[model samples]
Target: MNVMSVRRAEASRRAGGDRHERTVWPFAALVAAAGLVMLGYALLAQPGWLTGLTLTVCGTNPTAPHAVLLAGVLLMLAWGMARGRQTAWALALCLLAWSAAAELEAALAPSPAAPWRLAPLGFAIIGLWHGRSRFRVPLNATRLKQAAEISAFSVTAILVVGGGGLFMERSHFETPVSAPDIGRTVVSMAAANPGPAAFDGPAWQINGIALLSGGLVIVVTGWLLASAPAPRPAGRAQRAIVRAMVSHPDSETLAPFAMRYDKSYVFSADGRAAVSYRVLAGMAVAGGDPVGARESWPGAVEEYCTLVERSGWRPAVLGAGPDARLLWEERGMRSIGIGDEVIVDTGAFTLHGRSMRNVRQAVHRTERAGLVTEVIPERQLDPGLAGQLRRIHREWLGAAGREHGFAMNLDAMARGVHPDALVAVAMAPEGYAVAFQRYFPAAHAGRNAALSLDVMPRTPLSPNGVNERLIVDMIDYARSHGYPRISLNFAAFRPLLARARSSPESLTGAERATIRAIGLLDPLIQVDSLYRFNDKFQPGWNPRAVYIGSWFDLPRFAVAAFGLEFALPYDRRRTGRAVTAGDPGFEPLKGPAPVEAHRAVRH
Candidate 1:
């Protein structure tokens, strides 16, 4: 007896496991069944078996089969709900209920019609209502109530259109029919005329128009609901905060954590000891409130100075105010030569005396090296040669450990431009390319034509003189094209061989102070070297000054704010020597000023 009981228990356990597996996805079987039913009906309709069977079972009542199908769908939805599939169940139940309602309306009516015509409209309504909860979640109670009211209006539109059409046709419209068998004809005709009977009365016409308009309104509303935008993903912090706020609206203080890390600063009304930096432009705050400020070139400079004073930190202002040198002198600051801005005329211009000699030497050497130089429109330039230019650029970048430089992408360049610019290259007689330069036309009126030079690596080249030849060739090309000026744009400074010499040494107290401030912030030795290299170009120099609201309120802050990264560093060696050299009062001299004049020298 005991052995028999154990065997029965084991069998029962296996049966229970099978039942659990079956319940895992109850909707799967329903979906398959529905698909099969639809396929069978479509296929058998050719032989008239499906339609004939449906009529035989329902006695020519079109709604009977629809009601049975809708009931089956509802049962499937209930099964899904009982199996703990919430999302699936919600969608299925809504669809099932809508389908059932539509089927019942069709089935119980005095006349019934084909089911396919009602299917699309029923499914569209089901989709609109399925995910309504998610949309209403973010909205307030009032908005939710308003949405509900709109939903009612939409339903009213559908019902008035569907029901009114039937009423008007039956009560006021006449049907033009010719048939043989009275009973059979009545059934067929009535089924076909499920909508309102043909209307002749004026009131029926008006009601018909109203129903048509209402149907349009419902269709439009359904389309809008179906086409609504998808919900956006929420960050953890935002999601948490939203949840907390919704749960506890009265909480005054929330967690201090934020999704992003951004530095911010505040300052007093007076711009003293505020904040400043070279790379980063400090955010402006006034009286513990964020300040609204514009971000233009001039506005940026103004804000930079203001923040410096407010921050109460000290640093150098390489090239500062006109009166800055005087302040530097008073504060015992220092300064040095940085670089020069080179400019060349594309129109009629001549190199005289020493300038002419330099140009002649570069041209003579380039020609003697068995090389040819010419300017060709970028499009006419050989594709292979352009590729060589890009390769050279890559080599230079690799040597410099720099990822980005003036390298052109071949595929991009191949897609040419109108009135394309020129590229000048010096090719050796042996077919090896020696040097190349790219010239661009002026972008706008009043802007000078420009070009960038990149000479081959370590090819017995003198950067200064070779660069001069490249510039001359560019200028000649521009002139031939009728451009007015060709700007060199950038160049390294060489103080020892400066084309235009600046005044030996002369600076005021304020200028010395500002220079010292800049030096303190950026103490890198390489900066001065770069300055000297730029000076060689003999370009006109202009002092790019740093302006502040007030120096007294936040002197140190201003220094730190506009320190090293944003502002250039002052060379103490240069500024000190200049200051000590017999303070010569400001004297306006004529003739082309020295390149150092543009070097941001202390006043």
Candidate 2:
């Protein structure tokens, strides 16, 4: 054999080895299919004969009609299995369970017991061979040898018992045996009575039948219970479903929102409520009347108020309609400017002007510093890096005090609530993480994305130009990824910020009075300071107001007693002039300014 021939022959041998290794399971499956076919024919065609034989030997019929139906189903399943259908294999296993039960009942039966004497042994062989394929077991001639052994043992026990019973019966009839001699008989004989024995004497026939039937039932039940396949363990998706069902009230309560039916607000155990501000969108999609959509807001507001009253907690609501604000006022709930929603046109956007300047500078600086920004697919985010980014988030939270930063960012991600969004992180030169943002796709009438940015903690640099830089990076990222607009959220207490920027000369008399009254009892200065920080971003100022169906329904005494600092602006549609904070119209009741002094306040 030359080297070339030798190599070719060796490759052939290796290929053959692989083929042989893969054939074992298919071969076993073929054997199992053959066994199932035989069992099916016996179950469907000869069920009565089988049952009669079982009753004759066992003294009662234990096979249920459902068992026969299952066997037929398994035959169909076997056909599916022969063609390599996994679903068919699973169904076949279930059918096999019923077949096993029937077989066990036959084995334990007492009448005409000859035919089914081998039934239990046959079924046990099938189960051990096919069902135990996945279970570790020896596969050799030994399995056949074990079946033969069981058959031999079964035949020997049946022959001995049947022959011994016949011998005793024959002996009883052969001669007129004396009473003392008959008393020693293996089988019991009835005692002679003074009067002729009643023609049909009670023989404990029902009791014997009951005991035998019960025994067969217990044996069959035990075998079925023991042989049934254990359920496969839950996977990732199953685990997630369990968690959502058990722990998330928001998921359950807001299911209507998902189905685009109704909107709701859910309160968590921690006094946090998640209110859907765009509940009307879903109603609109369902072809609800425009007037009905308008009417839904008041009811939603009342429900939220009820939840607040019941839970004794308050949380911010997003994308609120005009009616929601009015309802908040009616319920005497305080409003604040938390953040703004920034929507940018992805296709129309260009990196230019003052808005684009900061981003431009940051990009240049980052490149000069040898730090690179790459827009990669979302899945490419390394797990280790993602974990590190989360740590940086914790650090940011620690520095800012957990109460001040965005509440939903960390909690939402931890719960795996938002799975549909794409996320990206920016890394510094030393591989230290700098920032991360999550983008949620648009829903309802809006086509926009939401971005969250956080710089590394303990960095002494000001956040002044950081947001614009992040926004630019995000916009660039989005443009490359084919996304349209981005929405930057506003603070809940945005009115306070609007108030601080307003000149006193711009206020009306009533507006000024309200502002003075609110400022006297609340931390107007502190709120003003916070709003000043958000104003630096130079975002488009959109003053959104709350709407109420009836202001009279509010807790007027509570509002008066608490002297709530911020109140939602009352809308005067004709002038488009909103009653806001810092309006000079404010005249303190007991201050140096007289009541008439407030009369001159005008916008």
Candidate 3:
């Protein structure tokens, strides 16, 4: 579909009317204001002094209670109507009918205020009817579940209140209340104002009726929620669409991760572009920028944000590139630079320079340890060899007790290995592979110049240089294959961390505080160590960021990000099994590591 048509469809879906339709919102607002005014008048108006003196000086208006209730109901309906809720429109109509009856009652009592009270209610009803189409968004599985859950909660509250009321009423009686009497009172045909014995029976019976009714409601609601169909997944057609877009030359380092099975897709109205995100802790976090035409990205972001908000989830974009950042900011989102990404220029990279001495030394040490390296096309790897790699990965995860994902990580590395992808492995002297790293092919700015590091795993007992060896081999392989750039791991807080570590004595307050904060994260993440490891390659650092709309959501976004990344240690089984750190099914990509320099240099 064309962009214009898509937007129109979206508008129609949201408003259930022509996008250009004039809303009846003014009348709704007027109705709410009128109700508030009536309430205020009833609460603040005083009777004439002589009448007040004759009336016992209670200082209360007889109309206040009714006015307050009417105002509250009106305001709630107006609020919901403004948000285009069909339920609010239905309730408003019901309330207006009830108010009309009240108006007739007042007129029969010979009150002059009846017509005035009915006017705004009549207008409200008209406005609600006219704008009924505004509530166009249909209730999906998520919404159905939400409605059922709300019904169940209402039933619970009603039961609690009714039980309490019954207890209070029964307490007035000197005799103890019996369960049988309570049941009898609930379904009782007895008249009101009965004796104490009769009251006790009615109270318990009323309580019993409440419990039965509420209990039935709860059960029905629960069953509906349970039986609701599971939400639709991104099927083959959607994947094909994304896959086609993934080749469009502007995809970033995080692009590959967007295709992971756990994520859902939101497309631009044109269907030419899409954003991928997973819901974690009620946050709809996009893995990165939209995956199609640059022109359609804004539309994709807008659609993603709108859908997420309507679903009652906080929308955010994480690990977005500089281009993605601009689009997110244009949408009025606040962004924070989360970290730096290291990209190595393969064509210009060489190990002969003095700066390459550390990496070269690590390579030599690994060679001396009889470590051999090989680069294999992922699709051609043997199943037994893949199994061996999985064992190594799980062992590493067991000790690390953590696996991180979402944006830079791929799951089930061996299961969904892409045909064009490559895996670099380092074989220990013992003749078995000790470490391996997976690299994904990606395009940037319409050129196949980029290869991204996706997964890295090394046995804890493997030689220190094993990881270095795999990286070195991967870089050489990329360079030989004519790829101009290879993306390394992300280094969180790299700039401030590098400054703090290189010259601690000259630290500013910000840097000092940054170091302290990083120190606190040392147990959870090797922030400094990872920075140092990636530094060895002397790659250019590109800043990475996360964009959000509110400070209150900062913590929520953090928790959601961590959860999606699998940073938390959780045991999948409930047995007395020993706890392990990473996913038993898959391990996410590892972050960049700093290379150790061959010679020490002055800061």
Off by over 4 Å in 3: 1-142, 145-198, 201-232, 399-403, 444-448, 502-511, 567-603
After superposition on all CA atoms, what RMSD does each candidate show versus the true structure? 28.5, 28.5, 9.6
Backbone clashes for every candidate come to: 67, 38, 14
Best by TM-score: 3
- Candidate 1 accuracy as TM-score: 0.31
CA lDDT of each candidate? 0.37, 0.37, 0.64
Query: What's the lDDT for candidate 1?
Result: 0.37
Task: Specify the highest-lDDT model's number.
Answer: 3
**How well is each residue in 477-570 modelled by candidate 3, as lDDT tens digits?**
7766666788889999887888776788888887798799888888768888888899998899988999875566799898878777764543
In candidate 1, position 427 carries an lDDT of: 61
Off by over 4 Å in 1: 1-340, 400-421, 444-464, 489-603
Expressed as tens digits, the lDDT of each residue in 1-603 for candidate 2 is: 997567556655664664343233453354354435444434666465455544322234423332333333434444433333333444445544555555566657875234453464355346534643332212223333544565456445433443344344443343554534333331121111112221132334222322333333333322221211212223333323322321222221111122111122232233222233211110111001011133344554455444432221222333333323444444433443333333455566665678556556755565555443333333334567656655655565554233121112212221123333345445556765565555443321223222322222323222333334445566666665445544444343455335635766776787677656655644533444434544434554334432222233234322321221111222111112222223456321111111110011001
Clashes of 2: 38
lDDT of 1 by residue, 1-603 (tens): 697567556655654664454342435444434434433543444245555533322223333323334334433433333333333344554555655666667776889655553454455445534533322212223433554677577556545553454453454446643322222323332232324433455554444443444344333322222211211223333333322221221111101111011112222234221111221222121111011111122233345433433232222433332322333222222333333334444554555556466566766676565555566555555668766655655464355322221111111221122123356665666775556555544222233223323222314342334444555666666666555654343222333223223532454566556445544643533333335433433434433233222243245434333332222243111111111112355221121122110010111
Single out the weakest 10-residue window by summed lDDT for candidate 2.
281-290
